[model samples]
Target: MRGTIHVLNGPNLNLLGEREPAIYGHDTLADVEAMCRAEADAAGYALEFRQTNAEHEMVDWIQAARKDAAGIVINPAAFSYAAYPVLDALKLCDCPIVEVHISNIHRREAEWRSKSIMTQVVTGIVSGLGVHGYALAVRHIAEVRGRTK
Candidate 1:
């Protein structure tokens, strides 16, 4: 593997296609993973894809990425609001981190939806592109990792 990239998804993501077809699109989580894998593979990188509803589990994954991954792509869903612990764990990572959001949180009418704690630590973010955002994030990691290598 040229490098390893961890693609982590937050709560409700497993329900992807069935959750909100209008905003999030009709693609399932599996579809997103497949797309990410193809993107990483094309860039000569290995992929580690995971999704969890538990905050602690997500933190543990982030901690693991700090040592085992060349980069990370995270879609923290609900955790984006105020998961301080998750934010702290992400801060520990020395590699590039890209935050992805299927919906354009900024355009949401709800004021709270626009706020993302993960933004503080991520190298960049891909939002409003639906499931394609995940692919973009992985592609970004691959490019950055390639340059670093």
Candidate 2:
């Protein structure tokens, strides 16, 4: 079966546009979804977009993607630092995984914020490119799955 690409967002990301305009930017989560949907459509693939403030819910979605999705584009947000369960679920994906960050975590103030446990399993990472990163990630997933023209 042709599968869908899951675009998942983590904790506090629900606050996108209003959270931290200087870092996260002025585009809301809805804006990001529109961008991802457009890219997924342009690439001829179905999209499954979701955001969660709870870690278990995020883990549940990742596990669900194992069977339902072709690939994943995730912005783990605050969970990036030490979500071992999330990392474990990601390890079972058996498909391309792209980790995206709206702001450059490396340039952020906190040292711990710069590290991501999921990085070891992700196929690619897009950072500091703002909301455009999500679209790039969808394109990359499409390319990896040979779904792009």
lDDT of each: 0.94, 0.91
Best candidate according to TM-score: 1
Give the alpha carbon lDDT tens digit for every residue of 28-133 in model 2.
9999999999989887789999999899999999998886577899999988988899999999998889999999989999888889888999999999999999
Model 1: per-residue lDDT, tens digit, 13-127?
Answer: 9999998688888999999999999999999999999999999999999998897698999999999998999999999999999999999999988999999999989999999
**In candidate 2, which residue ranges exceed 4 Å CA deviation?**
147-149
lDDT of 2 at 5: 92
* Whole-model lDDT, model 1: 0.94
Give lDDT: candidate 2, residue 101: 96
Q: List the residue pairs that clash in candidate 2.
A: none
